[model samples]
Target: MIQKRFGSADTTGRKLDVIGEYLSMYQKALGNTNFETLYIDGFAGSGEVPLAEHTDNLFDEDVRTVIAGSADRALNVDPPFARYIFIDKRRKCIDALKAKFKDSPNAERVNYSIGDANEHIQKICRAEQWRSQRGVILLDPFGSQVRWETIEAVAATKALDLWYLFPAGLGVFRQISNDGTVDQTHEASITRIYGTDAWKTAFFEPSKQTELFGEPVTKEKVVTPESAALFMIERLKRVFEGGVMDEMIPLGKHAYPSYYLLFAWGNASPKAKALANRLSKAAVKATDRKHGRIV
Candidate 1:
């Protein structure tokens, strides 16, 4: 089977490693609990990813290595999740996953969906069965594919923990010019992702020079990529009753800001919230110590 290829092997590997750590912790903590644990991968790629690693081969430039992706990691968690749902918009990816797990002993426990992840995840979150179920949903979108409404749906579940990789640089900061010019389409997209227009004022400020002409006072963007990511975490804290992790891991290649992994617990119980934060934070810190911070 052909494995899916992705760039920034170091960064992507670090993300999956952190997630893998938390998955193990999550299952061990709640494995014997009454809650029916689940694992949902919103952007589940082919079961494994092919990462290019440096090689000393004189003929070949690099060696391609296969590593378990999130779906595979979740499946292998020590006290496995009760159910697994892997969603991908690309039919080929879903097909690949189905083929990979078609003959597994617990294959029946894994559900594969081929369509928009946002729509499918929102539907799952809104289902009534969530009251008796608890799970972790990984929203590792390629860009800003995860809409704000979908996040709200997950928040409402009050059972599923969230591991959202917000596209801070590629999606948000890149769209907002230094002069604070946002086109119609970009404005709508940003608003949809943020669930409000407040980001405009939150990330931008009136230019002192423009006050003189008052009529079309130009706005100057005041947010750096790092600050923009922090803003997103703060916005998330407002919706998640369980609470949001304060230290979001910034992930990018070559020390550039690209994505920020934010963790939030949906369960309102204080103990659950605290445990969730503790495990997720440790996982992030572990990955950072192993790979060094991505700036």
Candidate 2:
């Protein structure tokens, strides 16, 4: 694949590690069952991302420059998935990925398509074949571009586990923290992202009506990034039956709410919580190691 300008983040390794480990366990437990395991990555960038460029300030001392990303790392998981599907909207990214894996033996098992990731997610869920289509979906958008509706569709699938990379600080939270400078476009975006007009309540207190003109004045409060993240996590937990976002793997030590890893699953089976718990702990440990949380 011709190198693209995009590169992996400092936390990329831990995220992929968590996914690989969890999927390995998943495959082991379900391999003998009637279900087929799938590995899917939406926003699967070029197969290889050079970390050297993206994390100079945080991880410049790390030995590796490039790292194997989700699309490639998914293939590396043990007991290999029965199928792999990678989606990206960029034509160059798709073309680069296709050429990268064209000669691999597992090439035949892959399905690459060019389109919007969220639209394809809903399409996949709505057309799901029940037990025949079990999967692990990765939603690592470039930023907070993922629509709330897409998450709703994925939850409806009831057969897939989701590993979502949510942008908290520099993405969604920042976009709305314009110091009371939110315009109509920003309001619309917040509504779309939350899938409701209710997010205004998180930052702004209810409006007060004046007696003189009977005009309403809405006061926007100071919503910290941390609080914003909690709001989102709670919202997702309500949507996903077995969803968990209590503890997350932050991208950096204290980037004042940077990116985070959130996993969601609706499977009622006992293994669901167990897997979530294990991965969450692992993510915390990984984040600690990065942030000097280690003893």
Which one is best on lDDT?
A: 1
lDDT of 1 by residue, 1-295 (tens): 5754554678788889999999999999998799899999999988888887777878998888888888888888888889999999988889888988888776889988999998999998877498779899999887889899999999999998999989898888999877788888888988888888888889988876665334565788898778878888877888889989878777776777688888888788979888898898878878888878644
Instruction: Tell me, by TM-score, which candidate is best.
Output: 1
- Residue pairs in candidate 1 whose N, alpha carbon or C atoms collide under 3 angstroms: none
- Clash statistics: count for each candidate: 0, 0
Q: How close is candidate 2 to the true structure, as a TM-score?
A: 0.82
The C-alpha TM-scores of every prediction are 0.91, 0.82
Candidate 2 on 1-45: residue-level lDDT in tens? 545433345456666666666666667666567787777788988
| lDDT, residue 145, model 2 | 75
Clashing pairs in 2: none
Quote the RMSD, in angstroms, for model 2. 4.6
Q: Please give the TM-score that candidate 1 achieves against the real structure.
A: 0.91
